[model samples]
Target: MRVRRKPNPNRNHPLHCPYCASELLFPDEETEFAWSCQDCLRVFSVQFHGQDDPPVKPEPARSSHEALANSLKRKGHEL
Candidate 1:
């Protein structure tokens, strides 16, 4: 018998266009990454990491995870 592992819970959060404030619909296409602000129509790119990269933008004081990730990436661990 085989057991299946559960996926990350956070990945379940739906992506939304920051500009239009509409739910971003992902197409059935295989792509590396994509981004677009729905409200401002600002397009951007996204890179995935285990628990880093999306540095907690607001609170600079309590950003240990972000700092650790950045440090790891700098050390060439792929963050």
Candidate 2:
């Protein structure tokens, strides 16, 4: 039996906000498999397996890891 492996969630394609040169944030309010940039309001989808055209999505800054970690602790996630 062949066991399929799950794709790495942290692994993502290199992305940039064409407008502000800011690295586009991944995953907006719609889905976790997407990304977006607030500076230019441009959305993008990353190819996890190095295939398919990049998609787009709208995302905010607070969606980032550091910000999210802070939010989690604030909401009571033990450090």
By TM-score, the best candidate is: 2
Best by lDDT: 2
Model 2 Cα lDDT, one tens digit per residue, 18-78: 5577875655645545567877777765555555555875464575778878988999996
How far in Å is the alpha carbon of 48 misplaced in model 2? 2.4
- Measured against the true structure, the TM-scores of the candidates, in listed sequence, are 0.26, 0.35
Worst 10 residues of 1 by lDDT: 25-34
Q: In candidate 2, residue 20 scores what lDDT?
A: 73
What is the C-alpha local distance difference test score of each model? Answer: 0.54, 0.65
lDDT of 2 at 51: 54
